[model samples]
Target chain A: MEFKRLNIVYGHYGTGKTNFTLNCASALAKRGERVTVVDLDIVNPYFRSSDYHEELKRLGIRLIAPISANTTLESPALPADVYSAFSEESGTVFFDVGGDDAGAYALGRYSEQILKSESWQALFVVNKFRSLIALPGDAVSLMREIEAASHVPVTGIVNNSHVAEFTTPEDVLAGYAYAKEVGAFAGLPLAATAVPARFADSLQDKIENIMPVEVLVNLPWNAGK
Target chain B: MSERVLMKGNEALAEAAIRNGCRHFFGYPITPQTELAAYMSKRMPKIGGTYLQAESEIAAANMVLGAASAGVRAMTSSSSPGISLKTEAISYMCGSDLPCLIVNVQRGGPGLGGIQASQADYWQATKAPGHGDLHILVFAPCSVQEMVDLVGKAFALADQYRMPAMILADGMLGQMMEPVVLCEPGEVQMVEKPWAVTGHGGRRPHNIVNSLFLTPDELERTVKERFERYRKIEKTEALAENYMTDDADYVIVSYGACARIAKSAVLAAREKGVKVGLVRPLTLWPFPKQDLIKAAEHAKEFLCVEMSMGQMVDDVRLAISCSRPVSFFGHTGGIIPTPAEILAEIEKMAGGNA
Candidate 1:
């Protein structure tokens, strides 16, 4: 499997969805791969990858949005420039979907073409702790539902199993294993895993080919800290 | 020549943001402000900028914080509930003295209020957004033209003061379609930011971007300094517009969409014997205190008409110090009052029946 196909990370609220996407986007961008991240989560009020627009821009990754004036925070639609970038044979693109199934439903319209286009991998992120859906069976069902709705299949799964500020490499590994089993049963690949950003780099040996989140924030960054 | 184009307030802001050289945006989608986000999504990428519909409003605001810390012009927007969620982040921006733009498309409520327009957020916005003595400069746009012009001003004031500035609008402002001049992309000036965290590449030590106050005294000091900046802002940025106030007997004080409605009321009252004028505030915070006070002296009574029950009425009473009979007539929960309603209120108040 390509280590970095155009990856998509999505799930319900508080499920370590952004943690996974940001880590992957940061890691990919840091590795000198041109990366583009679209913040498509229209529901929930926090914990999204779009919060790192400046950081991504500084890292040489292009950001596409409708924000031109300082006070204009209106998330209109995918700007013409984003499609231009997508049209070019470019680096990895990470589209972060919202937490609720309703938010996920929004992707059905805007991202249908992008999802069906070649080399796009949609990774469904899940955390067992949250009650949106539990058990591998439930996750698979949710994935199938999302795929049917968006006309896009979940290419893989990532287990973000832990409480905020309390997640460890072991928890991540356990979640990864769970995700792998779900992926196997769902007929999708277990693409990757996510360890909290604070886990020391020494823990990198705990899991191979996984993403590491640098920031562990339970709330959205709007609070500035 | 300024061309008139029919466009939504949010789209106008998008066009203005681009014209003003503000190329960064981070936000989650909320009602009444969704058009803004939708517009950004469609335009940002085409112009070599960034747009992301954050997983949540919190994430969207932090994305703005990150971009602002990097010294690039950035913004996040939402309605009242969304702004309530963003208080923690907004407080931090104030504490850090990080210049940024925050747009609150005012909606009704203390909770998940209806999607229609209301200005119930006057207190939360003017009050310290979070726990601090810090003040956020609030700009209230009265029309689509002001939405565009104020966006440019929002960025400039943000950079100049190194403070967070807000465009306090309502759903009416966000959804209204009005004729506006399309500013050429290069004409608007961009603020220079030297304090952005663009990564320390051996040129300087790592710059920590945060808003933590471990010590009370330290936090207090930061707040005091922010207050100093606020005082300076108050002196320079207080803005208001007067309409036919001279020799008028009664004045209508309002802002945002309500102000537009009140303007019509003034004309309607003028057709009658009631000499009514207007004192429309452009900056809701640091409000047009002096002008309101001055207008109160000439006008026998001040009528505060709003979509909300009495949000702006309190501000007028506070500003005028209850010098005149400040009567209020309004509706709450997304009910828009017509100019006729306001004119009736003016007539009643003028007839000494208020």
Candidate 2:
């Protein structure tokens, strides 16, 4: 699958959507493609892309976030720089939307511009391990809710399931099957299956559209690792 | 018996609450604790229970008070700042003598602190959950399985004592994943609340659930009676787990997630021929003072290790009555100390004795 000009990643909490977006942006930047990641997540204060401003800058990727994105202040202040993501003529842009319907509403503000954009894909990320959307039917309902709140229909499904650091290739394969069921229920195509970089080599042959992921977002408790 | 499954600490606590007949859960979303509320939101409706996301932590705690007054198992959970918001309702519950469970997956605090694992709320949870001479039963769990087991125990204690009980956990225990053997919903025995205000039906006198005692003398008598019950709880319900303390010369006092790191340090210190043991407090309120005094009998000195900067050390000193020297080692603001660092501290304490 060709990378679109604009990619919007949406998922339930703990589905690893932020990690997926970061890895995707890092890969595009490494390939000499201009990449800008917009942090549209205001619901979850922790583990957002805005916390990685220094890292993202070093990786040659631009990170546009809310006014006080990673600060202690609970401000809903969306920055004016977010408009740059839509106006940029070059570079791949990624939107890390928040986890729930409330978070997706932020994207609805720019829905008209997103709809008129030349090339864009709103990918619904699914992780079967999360308690909220463990079932295929629940995943479909969540996708519909995100679409309704964002005012942008989901273009594809990305199977990015894992049990945190304990994920194995078998877990990824099982999640791929679960994601396929969710894709069928949502009437969306299976865009990619994100595997941990360690397991990418052995599972690449079996899984199509493999998006090898490097875990970048570390929780404070897991800081030592 | 249900099979063991790998689950996050927050999810396990929620499932255990459900198994313990907790049909009502009211909470506002906060980091490190959002998973517990999310799990309750998903599972409560399926079991014909009430799962409400109140507008604020105060509202959620008040909702728990309402549910508990109706004679049902009710719970509310939040992180540090949110827990602070629920204190007013907690005080009300304590004054009214209502039974309810309050889970605090503590994070760095004082004000709007960082969202990370922390034990800084120890003093707040055990000493002063709310204003007045109020005491709430507090249980601290170190592991995911302990989170499940203690949640069931927390509800039981709440019902048995007819007071608010807190499951004092940190973000590390709330977010980590481990194997847990969940109790079957029907298997666990639940305590019945005979004092519940479930309508008199004209057959009995009307029971009113209120904390207001306008007369100062009447309020004093009620508070004194409550303190008598608290005294009995402190005497009978204090719990602690002692590891390798029999022949050790030094003892380390820790609880919650810090104990997990302390235990590893104890084992490593033992391997290096250091006589160190650990006293892990299971209940913080009815703090196992007697057990610590007994441990101090064999040990020369004590060290209190925590994720905060020496909050629980005062309790350790009070437990031992200043008979032995007490030391403290911790990292404040959500920085967890490594086992190696704790082991080095143990070696230093041991070297001082030599």
Candidate 3:
């Protein structure tokens, strides 16, 4: 892939956006790029990027999360340090935006700085097996909703489809077709196809732009390999 | 083979209730459990069902009481503080002998505690769901799939027994995603509510659904009659799962989300040549006393693990008649104990440290 100075990831909740964001941040850090992950996901109290604060720090990725990320605030709370993402000049920054339009409303706060920099790409993650956004039309409409709420135009779509830990190769292949449909409907380019790292080798011959990700941000029972 | 789809516990509970013929859902959004209501709000309208977000938790519980009196399946969900507001309605439901599903996706509590998962409501659920001398059928499911399975059973048993049923879940199960094959209960054959307050159509005497008994004698009679049904339920409805307890020296007793952590710890202990097992309670109200008595015969020690500061330990002792040396290990105030911590506790118990 390509390295934009900043990358914004937004999608419907449970669409594997956080997992994809973590994968991207880890990959960027491994490639020796200074990476800072701003977790703007106040919509979901759990399973967000903030839950992996220690893990992210161990990977040399700085995280800017909500004030109530690891606390019991009973509401979504964001920190004021989000402005630093715009000021930092050397490393790649990734904003793990919230889920859906309701979640993306948080991203609207920093949309001005992101626009002024002119070095960012807002990617909408799409999943084929999710219940509410299973259809290509539903996915595009949600993308439109996020764009309208965040005031940041989504430039590309990331096809990160799976049934949680139950993802099969068949689901990833089918997701490529689904992502293409969503891209056509919304006139956005398919930027990447996210596959769990275990399935990356078998799918390399058949799939393109494969972003193999380690499954983090999960429960102990079904914590995938 | 049943094809499974990934679903959060809260979503699975909402979908399972819908499949079991629940048409009315009254809810006030609260954290962790809010997704269940969100799911209901999204799906209820599409199915021509009633999804009303009441003004407060009190209003939501009353709405369920009203819908349940009209002989329809109704449900309401909330966390700890919210569940506290609904307790009055729960007592009234018990007094009126009305059956409705009440889901408590619990968070830390005492008064408006934190939003993370906690089993602090065990006593509130099993001992006194309401003020009167009544017992609500309570189920504690440990997995997302079990959450789906028990929602149907909870609704069915509630209707059968003519009392409120609660799914005592916590934030961990509600937020975690897992693959669950939702039971497609096609064409739900609803149980007939002959004593319901449905319009009579002038064919027969109108049914009265009331909890008000003016005279003390009449109230006592009602209490005694409810106790008789409770006795039968206690005898027949207790459910527990015994994991590798056949020849074990130490047994861990847990329920709900804590049980999963306990099971993992038990496995680790067993791998180290320490004889250990887990006895998980599926029903909290019935308490599954017989299973504990059976385990007490072989296991020399028992450990009660919970998310709260050892709330379920007393029940374990009462179940086993204080036969074995029972130890309690837990964390309260929204802290979940890790498997290693629990395993360390097991090791201490194994070394006869208490």
Candidate 4:
């Protein structure tokens, strides 16, 4: 449950990986711990953690993204600043990676330095509600592909499943069961199950190792609320 | 009515497809619209349906063509650029008179656009889905519940007309989560496809499904007949929703996700006694022209709001026939116009400082 020096979060699209990573970085910074989030998501243009640069900066958390992230240009060029994340001496660095194997390939380029680094955890985030990995077998297979592409072993599984704003306590618990099966099949430990802060208390008795999260990302259509 | 469950718009549309007896789904993965394919991949196997992740959008669309030709309910979906790739096969379906559903969870476009919400494909969906003088039925849904309802309707309309029908949604509608009441299991009334290619068996003449006509006269006759059907649909199937248009001076014309924001602005303007209202087009192709003409009776001017750079404005102008001055306001490439921004425009249209 304690913070790792380098935390790499990976998952399929719409698995709430970016939201989870943003919340994780914010929590660490709030705890008086130095934090930096490397926006390794070159695949997606919208809803990346880098889109929240101003908000993250106000929270004293650094975000280093690709050169053209959140821009009109679909550039695949990774920034050289990502190299500094691995070399940082005293802060907890989180790699908010892009969704599937294609996104994980970017992390493969840094495999040499990551292998020689100190304590780190490559966490595979799973949301059972998302397609492709709804089944335990599918989630395990996707984890294998992510590991193969990144050249980093997935040390843990993080159950961060919810159906956007319509998520219920039951949905979170159901995702916990699904994530547990995925962890068992992949032989990975369950790091934590995330629930929205509002429903955390209601779900406490049903699940263990709960990480309460606040939804940070919002599309333009959802601006009024 | 079924119990309401919170669902993503994409997942809800997939489940609705299943409920309506759509057993064959062919798709290629693209952002904003991938969840629908993912949902089908999981549920289709359990229900004895075919869920294939095709090699490309072109292949997937052709697969839909094959499945639909065999008398099965079939569909394919993609985002903006992916939809562009599928246009060729869609045109083939239109010419062959194949009934199928095509879902376009539109994103910012013109090229390999951003995977954000946009309504920039209105012209593409309404005017030119493919080459040739063809028109397919296009439905626009504003909410997750509407997505579920409209997908079933899209399949039915496709079959009834024996032409491709589209559910035109933006990335925002596809990705957003909201409570929705999925149709009760087995509630849908299935359409019978007697004209399908199931083999002759010496019982009847052999049926051929194709878009090709080597002779120019044959192709011209086919095109003319299809337009006849489109004309009937234009008269009977054009759908729109009027909000606060009963007694208004200025009417705002919008659709899809942008209409939601425009409705909010309309309500805010009403609170300030601006006398503004909204006319939301539900069918983009058969395009509620008569309803706009009706709204034009009381309205002094029309303001078109969209996620694109005024794509729908031309249609609004055509509908009103330049009887009143038509103004435009929007943002392109996924920058959604806010309700406040829309209200400012409404204020400006009403002769007030923006």
Top candidate by DockQ: 3
Q: Give the per-residue lDDT of model 4 (tens digit) for B211-246.
A: 999999999999999999999999999999999999
**Model 1: per-residue Cα lDDT over B1-354, one tens digit each:** 453444567777877887777789888877788768877887799889999888888888888888889888888889989998898888788878798888999877878877667888877878757776778878989888899989888888889988888999988778654556667776766666566788878998787777888999987887787778778777778899999998788888888877877887788778776788999889987788988878877788888776676767777888888788788887774666777777778877877533
**Chain A TM-score values for every predicted structure, listed in order:** 0.79, 0.96, 0.94, 0.96
lDDT of 4 at B109: 80
Ranking by DockQ: 3, 4, 2, 1
Error of 3 at B123 (Å): 0.3
Question: For model 4, how big is the CA root-mean-square deviation?
Answer: 3.8
Evaluation by DockQ, superior candidate among 3 and 4: 3
DockQ of each: 0.01, 0.12, 0.44, 0.22
Tens digits of lDDT, candidate 3, B140-259: 999988998898889989999999999999998998877777666684568989999989999989998889999999999998999999999999999999999999899999998888
- TM-score (C-alpha, index-matched) for candidate 1: 0.61
| Per-prediction TM-score to the true structure, in the order listed | 0.61, 0.82, 0.96, 0.85
Q: After superposition, how far is residue B131 of candidate 1 from its true place, in Å?
A: 2.4
Displacement of residue A166 (Cα, Å) in model 1 is: 61
Residue ranges of candidate 1 with Cα displaced over 4 Å? A1-225, B204-206, B352-354
**Candidate 3 residue spans exceeding 4 A from truth:** A74-77, A88-90, A220-225, B185-187, B352-354
